[model samples]
Target chain A: MPIARGYAATDASKPLTPFTFERRNPNPDDVVIDIKFAGICHSDIHTVRNEWKNAVYPIVPGHEIAGIVSAVGSDVTKFKVGDRVGVGCFVDSCIGCAERDLDREQYMPGLAGTYNDFEADRKTRTQGGYSDSIVVREGYVMSIPDNLPLDASAPLLCAGITLYSPLRHWNAGPGKKVAIVGMGGLGHMGVKLGAAMGADITVLSQSLSKKEDGLKLGAKEYYATNDPETFTKLAGTFDLIICTVSAEIDWNAYLGLLKVDGSFVVVGAPENPIPVHAFSIIPGRKSISGSMIGSIKETQEMLDFCGEHNIVSEIEKINIQQVNEAYERVLKSDVRYRFVIDIASLAA
Target chain B: MPIARGYAATDASKPLTPFTFERRNPNPDDVVIDIKFAGICHSDIHTVRNEWKNAVYPIVPGHEIAGIVSAVGSDVTKFKVGDRVGVGCFVDSCIGCAERDLDREQYMPGLAGTYNDFEADRKTRTQGGYSDSIVVREGYVMSIPDNLPLDASAPLLCAGITLYSPLRHWNAGPGKKVAIVGMGGLGHMGVKLGAAMGADITVLSQSLSKKEDGLKLGAKEYYATNDPETFTKLAGTFDLIICTVSAEIDWNAYLGLLKVDGSFVVVGAPENPIPVHAFSIIPGRKSISGSMIGSIKETQEMLDFCGEHNIVSEIEKINIQQVNEAYERVLKSDVRYRFVIDIASLAA
Candidate 1:
């Protein structure tokens, strides 16, 4: 057994506190990683508080992980000791199912989450990268480019792939008009990645407060969604709009912003069902879709794409002691973008 | 002026009565059609009863029209004076707009409905195919294949194209698993067309009462939506699901039946907005979209396809005098599939 030190929530009502747990021994195809930086995703907050209603007790919630390979099992060929690496939302999935494709395993059945889930054996608990050390299958481990720092690059594991997958899937390259709704952690990355892909990017934020930041982050235009004229002026404009907000907004109005045959994809989830009128998508033959995080292969490709574009998330670094306070600020949308935890602080 | 006689709704509350209206004088680009058969669509009932709230009174409600060419303008090169023809949902659109494609004019703005709408002049009211005669632009007329009879082929102008457009758009063909979500007029056509396209078809109706009819029409399987087990048994089973019923049902439940990267397309309109949970699509990267009727170009393709396959709507022919009673039966889903009115009875 490998002892791992981390912070975890023992119950839904309590804040995460220092805890120590034993990690499973490395399997033949596993790679042991010395977790360097962990990004505090909104999903982490949701899990710690059991907001999604599926959280397991003593859950160490982190999925956006970036680190260095400390050890590798005998059969692990893709990763070696001292290599920079990363892990995302899942650690394992059904490997041999006929429906499982190498490039789309994230959407398949039997996906084991990095935390709050059981491993393939269905007996061993799988903990995430909030810990000081994590062991993941070599196949799920991604390589982080040397130029992108681990702290800022941590959010790319989850936030980057969430936006990048839909953008690439919908063909958001040259001559494409893409809109990224919301100006938060996931959205700011969409602006950067979409603009890097040669797409004309626009930010539809609740207010113009982040217009300067949005424009600086490679957006060609920024509009305040609070104004009614925003809807009227931009009706039937975008080729694709990736909504990154979890708030209950008028989905029909956004559907109106797409041109004929355009798509509106949702990456963030609201608490309740959204009301959508058929006429919203009927006249233009538009679509409303949802995308989760990308597959392991695509996530690595995204990392390589970021390397070529010199892209990394705009992150605020904090020590492990300040994570509980960071959750409150995140709820208020007070962070500039993402908050990354320095794992070395855990050892101290 | 050309005199035309048809049954028209004088007001929202009263039954349709015999009314005489003037057809526009032939333009240099017009083709005059002598109406022979007209298919009664649900939209006609909705418009005549003012259910959609946009009906112009004295509306002549028919768009699924089959007829013969009584006259052709000097510039008409596609049709002769005695050619078999059909007129669908719209007779004119913004023909020269930048967004208008020759293959997708039905989704564009400035579309002139075949009935209850104005022509390009914006002053002359466009009455539809429920009349003794109709004057239409040569560009909007489609040639009916010689093998199909005028009455049985009438619904292809509307119902056939409505199902055909989305099936082709979503790539429902060989090796594809498709489910038609209703077994009414539009869905029965979907079953035949999807099966013709070499895709395996299934029917998900409210009850298994029509299971025998579904199988006879080429469905591989039939499931009753009213049975809860159907949802569980067919979860993640379809590659494409085309919903043709306008009644509000559990859209989320239907969405769960799609495979990864699958699409759920809507051709029917419900009066109110439907509530959809984000989880319904996010997990599978699924989509919910809408498609109206096809353009004149694709409508011609559908007619040619139907001709080759020997396909026609399963219709119950009724005299024009019985249309008011037919509307009541349609509201109750009592008709076998469609009711084609004998336009010769209009001249009696």
Candidate 2:
């Protein structure tokens, strides 16, 4: 057993605080990783505050994890000591279903969250990567390319793959026009990935506040969604629109922004049901869809693509002690893009 | 100009009455069809009663037109005297746009409604096929297959293509499990078309009252949506679902019926917005999309396919005088599939 130091939300009202826990020793197929960097995802905030209503108490929430392989069990063949790796949103799913056979394991009905849920044992609760170390099955771990730095690539495990899967599924490439709604953590990755996939990228944000950053991230155009004229100007313009905002907007108005046979996809779930009109999609053969974080295989593909294109999340690295303040900044949409916690700070 | 006698709704509150109007004499590319049958669609009732809020008074409400081409202008290449033909929801659209170039003219911004809307000239409200005759450009008219009957195939012009386009676009075929979420005019066609496409079909009606009819129409399974167990038992069961109901439903419940990457499509617009939860689609990579009456090219393909499959609307034939009564029955969903008016009855 390894003694792991991490931050946990003991209850909904209190801030995350230092907690000491014990992680199981590596099993035959397990690889123990010394977690170097962990990205603070919006879901972490939701879980810590019990917003989604199913959050288990004493939750140590982090899934966008990047680390170095510290130890390997006897059956671990893919990595040895000192290898770089990452683990994303989910730790395991039912592996015998047809979806698993298709490598779309995230859709398996028995999927287990990386944190705030019981592991396959159905009794021991699974913690997350805010800790100093983690032990995961070999198949659940992904190899990070040497060219990509761990701190910046941390968010790529979650936000990066979330955007990448939809872009690839919808065929966002040459001759395609794509719009990324919101300029926060997930959306910024969409602009970069869409552009890298040869799409004409446009950013639909609440304001021009992030125009320069969006352009720098490979977006060819940016528009403020709050401006009425923006809707009129871009009506029927996009082949694919990926909405990363977790708040509900006039979904029908955004549906008008798509061309015939276009798709509007969401990566974030709003608290309330989104009101959509059938005519908005029916008139043009349009679609409104949603995607979760990528499958493990797709997540690995996203990392490799990012490495090939020199793409990594725009991150604001902070010490583990600054996590509470970082969460506040995140709620205010004040972070530049993403916040990466330096796990070494947890040890001190 | 040619004088045409038909029934027209003079206002939202009144019954349709006898009216006489003039249709333009053939232009160089025109074909004048003497309407032999007109299917009374729910939309015809909606437009006549100003339900969609865009109806113009004195509207002749019919779009599912089947007729004999009686006249053709000098340059009319597609239709000649006595040719069997059909007309659908729209008469014309902005013909030079990229959408038109792609044969998706129905999505053009300047699309002209078959009735209660101005033509391409932007004035002179176009009367619908409820009239004795209609003059349209040759390109806008589709040739009815020789083996199909004029009365039963009339609804195929609109309802048939509406379902066919989405099923084909979503790739519903062998090995796919499809569900049609109503058993009315459009839904019956969906079951027939989806099954004929080699997909296994299920009917998710509000009651098992239609179970026998659904099975008779080639559905392999029929479930009553009113049963709570139906939702639970069929969860994650379908690859594609086409919703033809125009009433608001708890759409998230139906989204649960889809498999990973499945589609839930709507062809009818409810007056109120459809509330959708992002989690419903995001967890499974599912989609909520809509399809209108298809492109002219696709409509022709649908008619040809229906011909090959021996498919046509299950129509209840009536005289012109029975139209008002039919409208009331349509409102109650009491018609056995569709209602087609025998045009010769108008001569009295």
Which structure among the candidates has the greatest TM-score?
1
Error of 1 at A3 (Å): 0.8
Over A1-348, each residue of candidate 2 has an lDDT whose tens digit, in order, gives: 788999999999999999999888779989999999999999999999998899788999999999999999999999999999999988878877788888889877788788998777777788998999988888899999999999999999999999999999999999899999999999999989999999999999999999999999999999998899999999989999999998868888999999999999999889898888878887888899988888888999999999899999999999999999999999999998999999999867
Q: What C-alpha lDDT does candidate 2 achieve relative to the native structure?
A: 0.92
What is residue B112's positional error in candidate 2, in angstroms?
A: 2.2
Worst lDDT 10-window in candidate 2 chain B: B100-109
| Error at B20, model 1, angstroms | 0.9
RMSD of every prediction: 0.9, 1.3
Worst 10 contiguous positions by lDDT, candidate 2 chain A: A117-126
Model 2 spans > 4 angstroms off? none
